[model samples]
Target: VSPKGARAASAGMFITLAAHVAAMAPGTNIGAAHPVSVGIAKMDKVMGDKVVNDMAAYARSLALERGRNADWAERAVRQSVSIHAAEAHRLKVVDLLAEDLPELLQKVHNLPVKLNKQTVILKTQGVPVHIMEEGLRTRILKHIADPNIAFILMLIGLAGLYFELAHPGVVLPGVVGALSLLLAFYAFQTLPVNFVGLLLIILAFVFFILEIYVTSYGLLTLGGVISLLMGSLMLYRTGDPGMAVAWSVLIPAVLIITLFFVGIGVLILHSQMRRSMSGVSGLIGERGEAYTDLNPEGKVFVHGEYWQAVSEEPVAKGEQVEVLKVEGLKIFVRKAS
Candidate 1:
């Protein structure tokens, strides 16, 4: 059995326990089939204790069924100990262990086995080996479980949603974000996720958005950055070392997220200080020519558009004037000095 830790580890351990005759390859591991509670603040320790007890019981039962030393198996479960194939076979933890699957199968072929209290003879001397293939869902779930892929999907989803919010009329980003979120959720369903950590991540995004809306003297932005880092760190909590996110992924993700938010924050700040470039407000400070004499009201041509105009000073036709304010269907203008 190749049980490590987490969901697959538990399932693999259960499968191994169900086998009539079990043999492990050299250097193979077989312990720690327990779920780690993630994200739950209150019940984590309780869940850990329950899982340990349950796994220990299961290991003891399996050891007893296989006619192996139950005490050692129980101890292994309790202490999360894994032994080498040679040691396991010598200690009777496994039977007929071999360096490879073919050798193990050869040794087990035509051997007498007891399963579910029934004795049966294996007709496996010349039988063909059958291998099970993973289904589509399993394959996809495996891909999603990859830390790098999940991280990338998260970034893409966030970026898409941000783009959609910034430009409401664009439907692509919304669609992409929705799909990405669904994928991310599916991945999370199979992986051990900390909801509290996820909430912190969402809170970080909220803070970033608030920074854009309200100039907070960088306080919100700084808090947002810290929250984002902590959330990313807590995203996955598998007890197994192999399943955890690699430092390569974490370092790059942190750098990328930091740069992305910093760039966005700077852009937002710049936008806040920028003058309007669209709408009637845009017309202010723009010079125009009076098409007709303006005592208080007349017509002016600006940017290829004719507009009703008014001025405090008299302006002759074809005189250059600057727009001061816009009123209902008319513009207030001042003669160019």
Candidate 2:
């Protein structure tokens, strides 16, 4: 029985019609059993027609077995027709109309039901209907199965792993990423995830990381953004809207993640391009005082240490010199102008 303000559409309609005693609350509506396609792959007209015809036949059979309106059931499958509870009862599409669960139980009580070729009357009167609660594991799984939540987890995992890889020894990001990624994968087991979308998302991250090493000039970043957007939009393959990511989450997530990865890539590139600060290369172009006079050879004090130096021109003692190049414990120098 449908609750108030609820609907029994698509597969719900089939379930309702197939019941021994179909029911609906006063504000509820039913019908609209047309099959919808949500996959990237499209069904041809012929195959589509066959599926629709098969469903229509099935709906008609259920209606006939329950002695309801077979024509309406067929129309619900073929034309996606729907009706309110009162109208459904008028059309003989439903066996009863109930205001609530208690009323429904009272109304369905003593109803004749055929079981194993034997007619059995329902004894719902004073029969406590125990509502089974979802187990903790199942509840958590269902929560994680949400497309947005799963997508967020996947991104967090990727970002964490990327951060850890970029800066090794940052143990927190790696641990978080690994855990989030594992959880996301587990959630994917329950969701209708498209492999193409998953691949695109992974490819996007690859591009983001490559942007740091390769001279793409933002081309890789742009590609990553496009891939991420497409991946987010096509993450879930389902006819049900509830199973897909919401736009509110997708838009901000894509922008934020893209910017974050791009920013990290830029920083890496900048740091790589910067000059060395603490090696022999750092000694080049340093000014120093001659420690001893020499005929094109002398000792110079540079960077707080004395080094053997040879100059193209003669340099006197106490004369300042500039280091040119370093070669095996010796430094080439020129007299300071």
Residue 175 in model 1: lDDT = 87
Model 1, 219-302: lDDT tens digits are 988898888778878777756445555678877876777678778878877887898888888888889899999998899998
TM-score of 2: 0.76
Worst 10 residues of 1 by lDDT: 1-10
TM-score against truth, every candidate: 0.79, 0.76
Instruction: Please tell me which predicted candidate would have the highest TM-score against the true structure.
Output: 1
- Which whole-number lDDT from 0 to 100 does residue 205 have in model 2? 95
Q: Write model 2 residue lDDT over 230-278, tens digit each, in one string.
A: 9888788765436688999999999999889877877787888887766
**Model 1: CA > 4 A from native:** 1-9, 38-51, 145-166, 266-272, 290-300, 305-319, 324-337
Give the alpha-carbon lDDT of every model: 0.75, 0.88
